[model samples]
Target: MRIRSLTARVLILATLWSALALVTIAVAISALYRQGVERGFNNLLRAQLYNVVNSVSIGDSDSLTGSPALGDLRFSQPATGWYWLVEPLGNYATAPLASASLGVANLAVPDVEATPFDQNYERYYEMTDDVANHIRVAETEVVLDDQGRAARFRVSGNLQVVEDEIAFFTSRLYAALAVVGIGGLIVNGLAILYGLKPLDRARRALERIRRGEAERIEGDFPSEVQPLANEINALIDSNRRIVERARMQVGNLAHSLKTPIAVLLNEARTLEKNQAEVIATQAEAMQAQVSSYLNRARIAAQRDSVLARTEAQPVMERLARVMRKLNADILFELDVAPDLTFAMEQQDVEEVVGNLLENASRFARTKVVTKAVMTARDDEPTDGRRGWIEVVVEDDGPGLAPDQIGEALKRGRRLDESKPGTGLGLSIVKEISGEYQGSFGLSRAGIGGLRAQLILPAVTKDTA
Candidate 1:
């Protein structure tokens, strides 16, 4: 899966680049170490060659003579791959002096045409000896007499020893670099997390604004993020102003339209019965339509405001008391926690719960029950806010059948024509619930009566 977090992305990229750089450094260091070892090995062979040259002199027959001590035990052992030789060059006809290690074997010498000597009259090369051992040879020519007679001094040492040493060093180097690379990656990850802490804080602040816990994003953010916070706060203020303007316009429109409808209804009262009845019906329909649309516009504006909240217990109790007084024959029972709160405006909450209670009172024969409780919903996003409040109003009157329940929620379809209502109460409750992203439904109550269930966004007690 792709990493979506900024911290993880930065940490992953840093780890990859650090590992690559460390591997490259390890390789470069290994190469330099190997070069140094080989240079020292060659120097050792050259030093041995010099020792043999110093030990030789032109003897009585004016020819080269003398054996190299070398002081190494391998030189004294036969075919140990460490040896020295002193031989006259270019027809000198002198017997060559060799270390015991050369026993019955001669060191291979490269032809001068193929491998020429340097300005110091010295040359070095690597080859496998007769014993199948890899060896390095350093060769030099020195004049032993005034007659210009020159002899070649050659020294050989095992090449496998230098290679084994370099291999051991490279392995240790890799282990050390691996440890350092892992440590560096851990430090880089921690630094990235610490640096991004401000963004996390900003995220929490925005969540508070979304949940209606705060009116604005508030925190001390880093300079890089402070401007973003300021912009968001400005937008929220602008949105609140827009919602207020929309509410004012809705109120103005309702006032302007209601007066005309009322005037038309009153004017129709003096007409003939047939015309008066037609005019009154049409005017009432127009009034209902205007009220529904205006309510919808007001809800649409207030639903998105970040500062809307209401205490559920107080609103429910107040409405229940009012319903009990209005319907003296019905008993009202309220079940709600004092701390229960909702993320809705007080007016909208009053409108919704008041409608449910009034409808229940009208139909209930003996008792009406109202309840408010906090509940979790699976379909809602799991942000840091508290879950939701469920308000249930049930009445003990003869309820509608399953088929008639759906029709009762229609805008103008009151099932009982004798009941005095515009048939918009339940529909308004549903619309307001929908505007707040809540839910409304009807089901059979345990009290053998109609049950109205309303769910809306809730706030935690601390924030409420």
Candidate 2:
């Protein structure tokens, strides 16, 4: 997926939030676990201090001495990081004594004079030894027996136990949260893809509409997108209606203008010889201009209209048969592919093909060729508009130079006045082809005659 796409954006946001939530949960769990470990460790230390304080008494020499332990074997081992100490406070006539685990190391005591006692008459602090093992110390001041002589008792436990537990728990917590985060991301991605499927369907439907396969968008869309689909369908209907109305009005105007020109041609014959010829010439020119412009207007209106497909073979076959009867003296050859179709109105194809073939038949010395084939056109976009139906008409008659050929396509540009008809056929074909966004060109044919090529949109059964 593109990073800038909507799917990526949705997933990115989801993953960020999921990661944040999981991290928060992991931290909370770790915090609660550490608090529990600290409480349990402190309770054990308090018990050890109680044993040490209770075991001491005002000995014969006024010194503090105790055989105290927390029932842990590590206390008897040297430098094992578990120890208890009791010493006389305020220059009392007593010396300090400690567990065997302390060895020669000194157990630094907190200053009881500066530190306040907790509710249980005990105070706690932490210290580190030369070996870098963190140790927890719980200290309390107490008087031995009923005498006023005071003593300080302390129980030191290695903080490494709690630290190791927290480290292990933290490692496992991070790993578990990582797994959860990955799983959450996968589920989010799948949900996003499934949820956006309706949009993909809507996009394909729009493509089909543009290709003229469907007249309007049709599908079961999400509620959020259904209004957009409905709006598109409404627009397509509105545009077709507008085009239809314009075509009708254009047709009506053409007929209205043609009637007056026909009447003028008829009335000019009754005038004086000199004046009659002048009036008739002008009238005929007006009639030709009217017919030409109206035809162009009609073609432009229907060119881009969503038209029905017309089979190319049948149209060519029909034109071939009619041209044979019309040009009985010349030989006609047709080469058309089977099942090929034109994405245009049948009447429009007939007008274009009929003109091309009729002009070829008129100029041919002996034989004329009409060929139609389905081809891929590079000029059109690849989105369903790339396919084109190319129709080529060739004759064995004399052809014009390239410069004259271009001029011959101009309306009423008859190169040879001896020709029996007005030279408007090629002009009409060129203009109508252009209206459909197709192409028209003249080239030198292998038959040593002028070649007329017309390319129009092609339709297949699948695309249709």
Candidate 3:
């Protein structure tokens, strides 16, 4: 899976680059080490070649002779890939001298065209011997006597030994570099996480603001992130100003229309009887539309406010008491926790619950049950509120069918013409709930009555 976190991305990239760098270093170091080992091996062979040359001389019969002691045990062992030779040049008829390890097999001289001698008159090359042993040869020409008779002196050593040594060194180098690379990646990860801690803090602060626990992001941030926090706070402030401006405009529009509507109603009373009823009916409808839209505008403005919070217990209890007094024939039951709060203004809460309770009381025969509780939501909220407050009001009266439930929520839709209502109660509750990003639903209650459920964002307790 692809990494989504910034820290993981940084750590992964660092690990990949570190591994690449370490591998390159290991390869370069191995090559250099191989060259150093070969250079030292050649030096050892050249030293033995000079020793063989100095040990041999012209005897009484003008033949080369001497027992060269190089002080290496392999030189005395036959076909051990360690040997020395001295042979006359230019057909001088001098017998060749060889180490015991040669065992009658001669070390072939490299072609001058392929392996040219250096300025020092010495040539070094590698070849496989008769026994298939890889060997390195260092050969030089030296004039043994004043007669100008030159002899070629050659020394051979096992090239396989040098190769094995390089292999061992390279292996250890890779192991060491691997360890260093791992350590470097670990340190890089820790540093990245620590450096990004300020971002995490900013995220949590923004969450608190969204949850209504805070009005703005709070805490010190790094210079790199402080500008972002400032911008966010500015945006929130701008949003509030816009909502407030809209609310004021809505209120002004409502106030501006109310006087005209009232004047129209009073004027209708002065008209003829049939004309007066028509004007009054139309005027009342206009009034209901104006109130419905104004309430919607008010809810829309307050829904986005970060500072809106209301305790459910007090609102439910207060409404229940009022409901009991108003409907003395009905028994009102309230079930709510004192700590259960909503991230909504108290007026909005009262408006929504008041509508639900009033509707239930109007329809209930003898009993109405009201309940409020905090509930864990199934889906994550985009605004960072963790849970919801579910308010349910049920009445033991005639309930609508499943098809009628949807119709009852329509604006100005009254299921019963006999009931005294404008039919905006349930529809306004739905609109208010919707503006707050909550939900409203109607279902059959256990009491065989209409059950209205209102779910709104809840304020989580601050644990910090």
Candidate 4:
């Protein structure tokens, strides 16, 4: 699996190092076990050699003799890989006396003049004999009080027994180490996941802030990520202050500029007929332009503020009631989800919905319908900040041509001068939706008139 999280990275690095350490310890233990087995095997052979040396005696003719039986039955069996011998050194007038296991074959003792004995008065060697069995031999130079001469006493035991013991120990060791390794890795993985859970909570908190469901990242976090949350909260507050300052400035400027234009229009009434008409027309046009742009500036300034959601269903139902009162001759239909909400101020929703419903009422011959739905983005998962609110309004009057729909959205562009409107209603809706990173479009309705579709960001419980 790909390691994408900090937990996975820590688990992988810790597991690799721990596995190395376990292997090192296992190897050291195996080496010590083998050494212990060898030391014990050699001690047994030395004891047997000392027993044989003590059994020898000197005859009246100054000859050596010993035929004592060892306690082990293997020592009495021929070619059984256990043997002992006591023999005179340098022509002492006596032949060698050996265990029955030696039979007629001589023990393969290495030349000892070139080899020195250890502090225990014994020398040991491992060699293979003509019988094809590997064995350990211990030899000692003995001086008997009953005899005037010295002799060599040697004893042997098979190395195959010690090797079998080591093989058994190694199998058990491998099984034990394997169990420890697997168990350790599982424990380490769980520890890593538990240690990093705070980071996961922080990530979810950030998503809630982006969706505008919350104003700041909440709850306590680990020290490593706490500073990041604080910084993000500071930035959000700073941006809100800046937007508030810009809105105040725009409001003041509109008041200051509109007064002079109002005075000019009033003074135009006292001039000549043609000059009065021109000044009055120009002043009205200026007033329309100023109002349109200033409203757009105010909406833009407040678009990024983290605030409470505005419910769409209440707004739609309220507008439907008012529109019905104004256009008593037309039937108004309303369909909206009660929980549907927009991630913007309530005033913004009222402005956009009111304009669309008013335009529908003006043109519809007999019927108008408004619908608001909470929808999920097709390209995003249905969680957190992936939701949208869509409000659609339709009428049954004469609809616009496909080409005329584009022109209707432009400011001050009216298709029919016969219609009683400034041609700024749809333009205002488009500009407000754009400020919230939303969409607005016109299409032919099923009722034969125009359809205004507005899609904006939505707030959901998961985001909160």
Candidate 5:
């Protein structure tokens, strides 16, 4: 069994959306079901009230024992959830006990403009009971009813019967939501796991790569993520080869320099005191120059050889960690878009930051910051040729002068030449930025220190 890792952010978003969708559907279902039930409830009351109205009349005896013959009054107290009222005067009527709370006596006659004559008897109203439950009504004159002309009958009932039914429906709704909620969570987890199974396999393969067990990101991954894995593996392979080759070449170069280095040492010993001092001085300077060029070659070789689409944040993070390991008391911050990637290779990006950050770390008082952001020029449309990258390297140190900044990027133009730097750091940046068809600028940072902002051309390849 494989477990797929989901991003916490994306997982939260998906779950909320699912819960919202299910809740909306549940509310709509309850609303429609309640509407239908109430409609039927009102209609049943209307028919019952019509019957009682037609059956009533003014009698000489006033005993009120005889039921009206015009309309059928089947039973005196029917078992059906229905009731009726016949009011010869304002407060004279007999209605079911359920109608007491529904204020069966308080119903007002329908006003004209809003409720028409035919719609009067069909209209229903709700009222609360003593225990705060709902009830319904259908009260009107029997004269306009289907039966022959008769007295009026007002129909009413406690909707608790309907309320109880509504409660049952509400319970079922919650039960369904619980079922669907729990089921949906399970399904969501399963779906996320299933969807990411390929990534899990790819992860295992990537682990093999870390341990040198595999050469590339080759796995039985799904098509959606395979390309990413493959590209990463390809980049890893290329980076490894470039580093290994550079290491071997430098080793060979060092070995060849050893003999001349040893010869200069021996020759310096054969000269007079002052001449010997000059020779020794010249020999050390030569060795230092050779070392500087060799170091520059190594850095440039890396930048030139990285030839795969690379992610900047992970690469920068790894590099920043390595730098901190070497120097324990530096605060390194990287503000970068995680998913934003580039066509530049890993080592190439590494070389860009490696030298500059190494230089910044050496000069900074406390903190060094590296930031890479995806941005577009204000004049340029989003999908057009005007988008650019903004890479910033800043340090809180005494700033460089505007005139001195440009002159400092030359191969050997160190501001303080005595300070043991090859001056290849910023030069390499300028060269690489140009090669990438981007612009590089050096200025005073917002924090009153040196800032190097490199704006590169957008990733203009066939990414899709």
Candidate 6:
């Protein structure tokens, strides 16, 4: 689909993509964060369990006491969420366990520590039999070897407090993510909208340019895009000047052809009967060819007429004004019903309509109506997606038959043999149309009169 509003489309897509990326990153971090917190708490709690077990001691006579109590490994007072446990050759282990699931069930506890008052321990976790709940276990052994005695010590601690701390931190993380995600999206959205303000100005400038209210874009815009607008404005000004110069050259070129045409006519007038017939025939043919060349040259020059906006209305209006002054008694009216212009050169348009308009003005009942339209030009194939301009000049003067229509478009053929015209006009229109990738033909109009129509490819600023 084509995006109609560039600014809005860009802003919307950008914001959406950014929000999605933020959410993806946040989810990944949350998962990793929970795992890290759980692992950290588990390590610290297992170490405390190992130390507490080593502090409990038992005698050969089943007497229970420690030479020195374990320090800081277990709570001083009873705690609601956690507690310590010890069992050394005792019938009942006071801890509520689902089973007696010791971690290394059959391994003998070693008495390797040389210091009697120092604590050295290894950490482990297990699920005891009675409650079948996870518990951290640790142990130590002692013997009354000096007095023919033996002893053992074992201790353990509950890990539930450490687990709860990790859970609390994880819960807070969820709330923070929600607040940050929403806040970040809002901040980013405002930044994007403000950044695209220059694009809005550029759009309005283009609209004004189309309406002819402004000649070039000149607005306070962002630095990044200002250069593009400036370049486009420069190019428009350069093209308009080139078109104006080409028109002047065309006028000079056309006037130069008239002198030679006049000389040929005068030369034919002084010839004898046999010689006059041959010379007049050759002269008329030569004059037609010359007129045709000048007309094409003029069309080429006007290709970018007022920067490819060669509306027939304005050009026809000028033609009508010129005809009135040329012959005050003749009645000439340009009957262009729909006044939309053919996307062609001013001179090519003027020549096609002007020549036929002149013909009707010379031969009509003082009535000439020039009709034109804009459609897909004939030369543009049906499969082509090109917009074209078609301009038709018609007259109620004597019409032509099917055979005469083809002859009328021939390079050197003239409809009325004795009519005053350098038969070159229509053919010139044909050549110019072809040069610009268009078509030219002759047919009958809706008014049941002679119609000359030229179908031309729309001339753009670059092509023109």
Tell me, by lDDT, which candidate is best. Answer: 3
Task: State how far residue 250 of model 3 sits from its true place (Å).
Answer: 2.9
Q: Write down the lDDT of every candidate, Cα atoms only.
A: 0.86, 0.82, 0.87, 0.83, 0.65, 0.59
- Over 239-351, each residue of candidate 1 has an lDDT whose tens digit, in order, gives 89988898899889988988899899999999999999899888887787787778778778777666777878778888888888888988999999667767888988998
Task: Write one digit per residue (lDDT tens) for candidate 4, span 288-373.
Answer: 77877887787777775656368777777888898889989999999998888788878778888898988888889999988888
Global lDDT of model 3: 0.87
Give each model's clash number: 0, 0, 0, 0, 1, 12
Candidate 2 yields a Cα-based lDDT of: 0.82
lDDT of 2 at 366: 90
Order of candidates by TM-score, top first? 3, 1, 2, 4, 6, 5
TM values, all candidates: 0.84, 0.81, 0.86, 0.79, 0.47, 0.64
Tens-digit lDDT track of model 2 for 289-360? 676676667666655555446778888899999999988999999999887878777777888899888888
Which digits, one per residue and each the tens of the lDDT, describe model 6 over residues 110-172?
334532323443334443423343444444433423443433344444556456765676567
Quality of model 5 by C-alpha lDDT: 0.65
Of 1 and 5, which scores higher on TM-score? 1
Q: Give the better candidate number (2 or 3) by lDDT.
A: 3
TM-score winner, 4 or 5: 4
> Cα deviation in Å at residue 307, candidate 6?
1.5
- CA lDDT of 169 in candidate 2? 92
Number of the predicted model whose TM-score against the real structure is largest: 3
Question: What does candidate 5's lDDT look like per residue over 1-464, in tens digits?
Answer: 44353555456767798789888988898889888888787777776665555555545444222343323342233433234555543344433222322333344445645654454545566554344435565656543223332444566666766777887998999898979887887787778877877877887776555433566777577779978987896777778788679868977998899799889888889989889877876776677567656655655555433233466668878988998997688788788865556545555577777877887777777788889888766544335644466889898877789998879777556786545556667777776666655667888887666898877543433221
Worst 10-residue lDDT window for candidate 1 reads: 378-387
